[model samples]
Target: MRHPLAHALRWSAVGVLTAGLMCTGLTASAVAAPGSPPDPALSTPGLPPPAPASPPAPASTTADGLALTPPMGFNNWNSTHCRAEFNETMVEGIADLLVAKGLKDAGYRYVNLDDCWALPERDADGRLVPDPVRFPHGIKAVADYVHGKGLKLGIYTSAGTKTCDTAGFPGALGHESSDARQFADWGVDYLKYDNCNNQGQDARQRYTAMRDALRATGRPIVYSICEWGQNRPWEWAPALGQLWRTTGDIGDSWGSMLSILKKNLPLAAYAGPGHWNDPDMLEVGNGGMTDTEYRTHFSMWSMMAAPLLVGSDLRKGSQATFDILGNREVIAVDQDPLGRQGTVVSSSGGRWVVVKPMKDGSRVVALFNETGGAQRIATDASALGLPGTAGYTLRDLWQHRGYNTAGTVAATVPAHGTVLLRVTADRRWAAHPPAVEPGLDGDPLAVAGRTVPLTSTAADLGRTTARQVSVSLSGPEGWTVRAASPRTARALRTGRTLRTSWELSAPPGTPTGSYGLTLRVDYRAPSGVRADSTLPVTATVVVPPPPGESFLSDLPWVSAANGFGPAERDRSNGESAAGDGHPLTVGGTVYAKGLGVHAESELAYYTGGACDRVTADVGVDDEKGGHGTVAFEILADGRRAAGTGVLTNTMPAAPLSADVSGAHVVRLVVTDGGDGIDSDHADWADARLRCRSAS
Candidate 1:
C-alpha cells in the first residue's frame, strides 16, 4: 500500500475554510515533501532491502527441471476463498474448463487450492486432514481427477503454526517431513508456502527445510515462496523455489496493479529460467477494471515474465476474460525459451517503453500509458538494441496485424492501456502497407448540449509513405461531429502526422456516462496495398454538481474504484457487495450522508471549476471494532489540496477541509496507512462540497 504524505494544506487549521470560501496560504509543515520516512510503527523488523538499485550476481537455478518458464495455472483464492463455491465441484469444473475452454491448449497446466483447504487440527496420526465439506472426495481423489485431465494439482500451507485464513488451519511448521510425505503420497505437484504466524523464525532456514523435505520425497513439487517481499526473497529464493511473490496481495484495480508492477520492475535481473518473480496473480475477470486495463495488466505481466495464474472464477468467466488469459502471442513471450525478463528502456510521465528479447532475436516492445488520458508513446529500433536495418517487421500482437516500419514503433495508447508489438529485422518489408496509427488530442469530457473541440492525429510510422490518407471521427447515434479542418491529405510522409480538428456536440439529453467514439484512418502504399485502422476513443459526459452546498453522495461520480467490494453510500464498507454495509459509523457516531469505502479507494467527480471548497469528517469506520488504519486525501485536478494524517478506528473522526477553486476534477482518495489493507474500512462522513453553478 502507498502511504505518501498529503499535498500542501491551504488552511492553517481544520474547519477554518467555510462553505463557498477559499483559503489562500499554506502551512509550512503541510507543505513539506511527501516522501517522509516510513512510519516506525509500520516498519517490519529484520526485513531485507525493498528494492536494490543495482542488480546482484546472477542467481543459480534450482535445477529441479520444473517451472522452466513461469507457471501458468489457476488459483482459487482470489475469486472464492474458503467460500462454499470453492468446493470439489468447482475444482473439477475448473479442470474441465481448462481443457474445454482451450486454456489448457494455451499452456495453463496447474489447478491449485489456496488456504482453508485443510481442517483446523491435525488428526491422531499428526498428519493434516482435508476439509470434508470442501473436498468431499479427499485430496488424493481430487488430485487423481485433475491428473486424469493431464493437469497438476497444487496445495497451500503456511510456514508457521497456522495458515492465513481466519479459520487458522493447521500449518506445516514443525511437521515438514510428515507434511511433505503426506503431500507426496496424495500426488501433489506444487506447494505454495506462505509466511504468516511465523513465530519469529528465520525465513531462509524455514523455507529451506521444506525444500529439502519435499526433495527427500522424490517428488518434483514446484516450490512457491509467498512471503510478500518482506525479506527480499529475490536475493535468495532462486535456488530454493520456482517462484517468489515480490509484493503483497494484489487488488483488482488499476492503482493496485500499477503499484505492484512498479515494485517488480526494478528486480528484473533476478528472474530467469526455472526461477521467476511473482507479482501475485492475474485479476483479468475480477471486474475491478475495464477490458483495456485488463489488457494492460496481462501485457505487462507477460512482458515481465511473471507467473500467469488465473485468479478469476473460471466457472463464471466472460469471453473478454478468456480472451485476455488465452492470448497465445503474449503467453509465448512469457514462456519464451530465452528465459529473459523484460527491462525498462525508458519511463517518463507515466509513459513506459519495456523491451524483452525473444529467443529468435526479436524484441517484445510494450508501450504502456499509465496516465488518466490518452497520449502518444514511441520508441525506435535502435533504442530497442536492434541493429540498423532498411526495414523492420512490426507485429501488433494485440491487434494481430503486421506492418513494414522504417524503425519507429509507436502508438496512441488509451489511459491505463498498453500497445504490445514484436519487432524483428526484415529487408523485404516493403510488401506490406505502412503503419498509420490513430490518436486523439484535447479533453475527452463533454457536457450535454455543449460543443467540445477535439483533434485526431494519424501518424505514419513505417518504411513507405501512406498515400491518400483519410481520417474521420464518429460518435454515438444522435450526436453531431463536424470537421473544422481538412479530413484528408494527398500523402503522409514517414515519421510525419496529419491532424484534423472537429467540433463534437452531444444531445441535450445525453446520459452521463462514457461513450465510445471511433477514429478511423484509411491509406494506401505505393505498391497499391491498402489498409485501414480503427481506434476506440472514450468520451465521458458529465453533469457537474449544482450550486450551493450538496452532500457528496448525492452527486454522480465520474469514476469510483474500491479496494474491497464496492464503495457504499450512507453506509460502512462491510464486505464485497453493494448494499451489504451498515449505517456509516465512525468513532461511535452515525452519519446519514457520507461515502463508505475500503482503503486504496478513489472517487472522482467533475467539478468543472465550479467548486470552491470541500469539507468532511474523516476516519476509519468503527464497524471494524477499532482495528483498521487509513489516510484521507483530496486532490484538485491531480494536485493534492488537503490530507489527514494516519487515522485509526481508535481515534475520533477528524475534521477535514480543502480548497478546490478553479479545479476541473476533484478526487477523494483513501489509502492504507503504511500497513496492508486489512479491515481498513474508511469513511468520509458528512461530506459536502460547496460549488457555484456551471457557466
Candidate 2:
C-alpha cells in the first residue's frame, strides 16, 4: 500500500494565485477557481465543538489551576551534566544571565534542572536532599534565588526504582504523594516526571497517580510525560498534563530533528491551547547546529507549537545564538493563545512547506529545504484558495519584517535551512469572506469498505474544474470518503468536506467506505449575491480483501515472514531478548548456552577480521563441503585466542578439546557457490549458521 503522506498533494498541478491589477482587498471579484473534486469535510461537524478552553493559571501559585499556552524556560540535561552534585553556583550564575539576557521578560520564566540534583542517598525520613558540598545554600535556597529572579523553578524525578542519574533519590511510584509534597515544600514549580523503569504500569495509571498526587499537595505543577511514544499518549495525556513529549529524546542533528518532525505531523489533532505536543526541547542557540540549521529548528518548533525549553548554555552564546533564540516572530506563534499546531500540507524532494493557521487569522508558514542543494520556493495566492484577484502581505519572520507580495514571492533557502514566513492580508485590504456551500458533508473513507472510482462521470465526480465543492454523505456511521490524488487540498470541516475545485484529480489511492456521496460548495459570495449551492455527485466504491488472506494477516511483515521450513522460519518467538532460530546444517547441532536470546542472524562469507567488525551479505547459501566439514578454527592471525571448540556446519559427536587459535575472530564461508539472499530471516536456538548465520 502507498503511504498517505506521499499522495496527500500533487506537485505537477501546483501553481500560484495572486491578486489582479484591478483587484484590491474587498473590491476583488474574480475567483480563478482551481479545479478540484468535491470535499466531504465541510458538510460534517467535528466533535461537538470542543469545550471552552480554560484560562491560564498563575505559573507560581497553583498546583493545577489552568494550563498555559506554550511551556516556558530552560532545561539543563542537553548542554551539561551534573556530576556528584548539581553546582549551585552554576545554577545561580545561569539564573543571573537569564534575567540579564531578558529571557525572563519574554515569557520564559522557568529554569528547570533535569536530574543529578540529589545526593547519593536519602535521609532517614526518605527525604531527598541536595548535596551540601556542591550546594552549600541547599535546594530551598536555590529555589528562592530563582523565584527572586521572577522565574519559576522546575525539577526532575523518575517513576522507576532509580533515577537516570543512577542517584538514590526516591522515585515516585508507591511514594507519589510523598514526592509531590516534598516538591511543593521545596518550592519546586514544575515537575518533569520521567517514565524510565516503570514499564509494568500503563502510562495513564502512572501519570494520573502523579497528577492526583500533585493536586493533593494543593500545588500547581506542570506534568511533563516522557514515555517515548510507547503508549501513544496523544489519545489520553492531554487530560492529565500540560505538555507531552510526542517523540523520543532529541539529538542536535538534522536527521534526528527531521525524523521527529515528520513522524509527528499526523498527531496535530491532539495539540491545542493548554495541551502541547512537545518535540523534546529546543536545540537552538546550541553549537551543534549551524546558523541555518538553528533557524530551521526554531522555525519548525514554533510552527509545531512545541514548548520553548531552550537547552543552550545561555551565558556563553554568541550574537548568532541570541538572535536565533530571541526570534520574536517565531516565538509569537508558539505563544499564540489559540494553541494551534501546524501540520504538513506538501512535501517533495526534501523541499517541504508547512502552513499553520494562527488565531489572528494570519498564517505561520515554514518552507524547509532538506535537499543537498539550495532551491527557490514560490507559491501563488491562488494555491492558497484565495479569490481570483487576491492580495497578500508577507512577513519574513526571521528578518522580523513584512513586505507587500503579489502574484508570487520567491526565496532561496539553503540546503538543510529554512524560510519562515508569516503570511497575512495587508491591513489596508479587506479580506473576502469564505463562501459556505450548503449540504457539504463528506470524509475520507476507510480502506476496507467499498470504493467509488472518481471519473468524468458526473455521478462519480469524474472530470472536474477548480471550484471549492463539498463531498456530502448520508450514512449510518457517517462514512468516510478519501481522495486518491496527488495534491493536498483544503479539508473544510469535520475532516469531511474540503475546499476544492472540479479539477482536483482523485488522490493517488482508491476512495472507499462511503455509503452515499454528494457535493456541497463553499466560496466567498455575498449572502444576497447568492444562497448556498449544492453539486450532488454520488457513486459506490467496492474494495475487497486479497485472495486467501485476511486483512490483518496480509500486512507486509506478517506475509513476508510467517512459518518455519527447511528454507525459512519465523524466529520472532514473541520472546524478549531471545535470539531467533539457529541456522544449522540439516544434520548438525549448534552448541550454545542461554537457549533463547533475541538476536539477529544471517549467512554470508566471513571476512577475515574480528567477528564483531565483520560485515555479512545476509541471506546467502553455502555450496561448499562438496559435503565435507572443516575443523573448528578460531585464530587471531593464526594465533590462539579464547574459546576451545571447532566451529563448522559439520558437528562432532562430542565437544572438541581446547585449542587457542589465537583467533580474535572466526570466519565461515561456502567453499562453493550458492544463491545470495539479503535479509532472509532465520533462527538459531538449536543450530548454527550453516550456509547462513541464524539468531
Candidate 3:
C-alpha cells in the first residue's frame, strides 16, 4: 500500500527533502481513481474495461531462477505498519522466535523488512543509507545476524523517486544501481519493490530498471514486485521478478482472503516453477479470522503456490497458528517438484473442489464449503484428471488419517472450512483412523482483569479408547489460563464424552480487545496414535488503560465526538504537524516526540480513580493550514476540566487542568473555533490523568 503521503517528499538533486506548502485536513482514498484500471480482478458483470495492447515481453525471470517455490518467511509490513515494530530489534526477535519454534526447520526462511528502512534523505554521495536510529549497526550487521541463524534477509525499496516518506524512508529512484549494489553488499537475499512516488512513471520500465540493476550487482536476490497488482502483473511480471502481486493489499478477514483467492484463482495457470503469483502476505495468526478460516486460507494459498510470508506477530503466535503455518505436508504440496498451481475444478451450490497435481503421480483435493452452514460435498475423480484406479487411498493430511478414495469423495465440511485430502494410487482401502472432536461448551467474553470459566469437551467419534485426555488453554501474550481440572478422566472410552474446565484472565497491561483461546486436547488411541483435535475458541477482554495520563495514540478507542469527522492518528510524532507545515507543537508546549495529530478528536476514559488531577495541553497544529484557531478542552462526565480559549498557530500550548475525584467518564475534545475551520489541526498534546489506587 503506497500511502498518498509519500508523494509529498520528493527530493532535489542536492538531497533536500521538500513538500508542498499546504495544509488541509483533507485525505485521499488509498483506492485507485475512477477510470484507472481496477487492480486486476475478474471484472464485475458488464463492467469490463478495454484491455491494453500487448507490450513486448522481456526475458523471463526464470533466467535468474529464484523463488522456485513461493518464498516462505515473515515480513514486518502487516504486523507493525512501519511503526515502532519496524526496527532491528523486532526483526531479530522474529528470527529468534522462528528458530526457537522450529519454523526454520519447516522451511520458513527470509525475514523480510517491508518499507521504512532508510532515513528520509540520501547521503552526500546520493546513496541510500539505513536510518541510523533504527538500524544503528547498519544493514550489513543485521544481515549478518540473520545469516548467523541460518536465515536470509529481505529488504524493501520503492521503484519511485521517494519511498513512503510517510515513514521518512528514502527511495532508489535514480540510484537503482547504487541501491542494488548496496543491498548486495549487505548480503540481502530478497527485495520487495514498492510502487510509491513513481510520479506516474511506467511500471514495467521502472521495475525492469531495478531488475537489471539487481542482476548487474551479480547477487541472487529474490525479487518481489509489489505494485498492488494494478497492471495485472501475472500477464507481464514473470520476466521482471520471481513473483508478482496479483491484487491490492490483502485484509486479514475471510472476505479479504477469499476475495484475493477469487482474483488469483483465474491466474493460476500463470503460476509455475521459478515465477509465481503473489497475493500479498499471509495473515494467518492475525486476529481477523478463526482457526478454521486460517486453515482454509493456508490451504488455498498453498494450492495456488502463493508466497507464505507470515504477517502476524510470531512471538505471540499460539500452537494452532504454528501448526497451521508449519505443516510440512501442506507446504510440500505447495513446494511440489513439478511446481503446478491448483485449479478449482468444480463449484456448485457453494461447494468447491480444487485439485493440484503433484510431481509424483498423486493429487491433492480440497473440498471447500463456502455456504452459511456445514455441507456434505462430493468430488469427481475424473475432474481432478486422476488416473482411474480402484485401489487409491485417501490421506487426510491435517487429521493424519486415511480412508478409501471414492469417485465421489465426500466429507461434511464446516462452514467456511476446508477438508484437505491427498489421494494416492497403488494403495488398498484402509479403515478410517479413530477421531476425536474437541470443542468448548461456550465461547466466553469478559472484561480485562476478570476471570472467566473455560469449559471444553472431547467426544470420541470412533471405537478407540483415547488415553491421556487433557485440555490445555493457550492464547497470545499477556493472558494465562489456569484449569481446576485441566485433565479429563484418566481415559476417554469410545462412545463417551470427557469434559474439562479452566479459569482464564488477562493481566493488568493486556489491552482491552478480542483474543483467541485454543483448546489443545492431547489424546492417544490404544495404539498410542490415531487422531487429536485442536479447537479454537474466542474471548473478548475489556480493560481500560491504567489510571494515569494515557496518550490518545495508546488508548483503545478515540473518535470524533457528536458526529465530528474521523480523528486522524499520527503515531509518528511530528508527521501530522509537518504535513500542515509547522514545528510539531501542541497544547502550548513543544513535544520532540510521540503521536501528534490534528484534533476534532475525542478520547474517552474511565475516570473511576481516587486521585483528582487531569490536564491537557492544547495549541494549533504547526503546519500551514494547521494555523487556524482551534479550541481544546478536557471534560469529565460531560463537564469541562480544562480549555484553551481559541488558540492560533503562533500560540504555544495553553494548559488546562481540572479535578474530578468522583467522575466516572473522562473525555478530551479538540474542535475548530467558529472561523471557516481551515488549518484547525488542533493538538490535544500531553493529556494526562493522576489517579490513586482504590484499596
Tens digit per residue, CA lDDT, model 3, 1-695: 11223223333232222222111000131112211343422521111222333434556676667888789999976656656557899899999988999989988999998777788778899888788888999999999999999999999887766665454356677889999999999999999887766667677888889999999999999998887666767777888899887665665545446656766766666777788878888989876577888999899898888888998889889999999998988888888878887877766655888888999888899888654334556665667787776535667778776644434455656657888888776545434433455656533545567777777667654444668777677887877787777466678765577777778887766665557677777776566664456755556554434655555445554222211122434421222223322344653346543234433334555554444877656676555333455576667665676766768778766777878677655666555454223334565556566776632
For residue 511, model 2's alpha carbon misses the true position, in angstroms, by 56
List model 2 lDDT by residue over 1-695, tens digit each.
Answer: 00111111111111111111100000111111211211222111111122124423323212345456778788876666444323787788778887887777777878888776777677888777777887788878999999999888888877655454433355577778888898999898888877654535666788889888988998777878765454666667777888776654555545345545654555676787777777788877655456777888888888888888888778778888877777777888888888777766566545676778877777777878754334555554455434443446666787564444443434545556788877666543222222222322221222333343332111111011213333432333444444444222232221132332222222335444223344434322222222123333322232322222121111111001111111232232211112323432223333231111111111111211212221111211121121212222222332322222222223332222223122222222111011111111222223221111211
User: What's the lDDT for residue 624 in model 2?
Assistant: 17
Root-mean-square deviation of each candidate, in angstroms?
Answer: 9.0, 23.2, 13.5
Q: Against the hidden reference, what TM-scores do the models get?
A: 0.84, 0.54, 0.60
- The candidate 1 region of ten consecutive residues with least summed lDDT is 16-25
Q: Of models 2 and 3, which has the larger TM-score? A: 3
Question: How do these models rank on lDDT, best leading?
Answer: 1, 3, 2
Cα displacement (Å) at residue 553, model 3 = 30
Which residue pairs collide, candidate 1?
none
TM-score rank, highest first? Answer: 1, 3, 2
- Identify the runs in model 2 with alpha carbons over 4 angstroms from their true place: 1-65, 382-389, 407-409, 427-695
**Residue-by-residue lDDT tens digits, candidate 1, 89-119:** 9999999999999999999999999887888
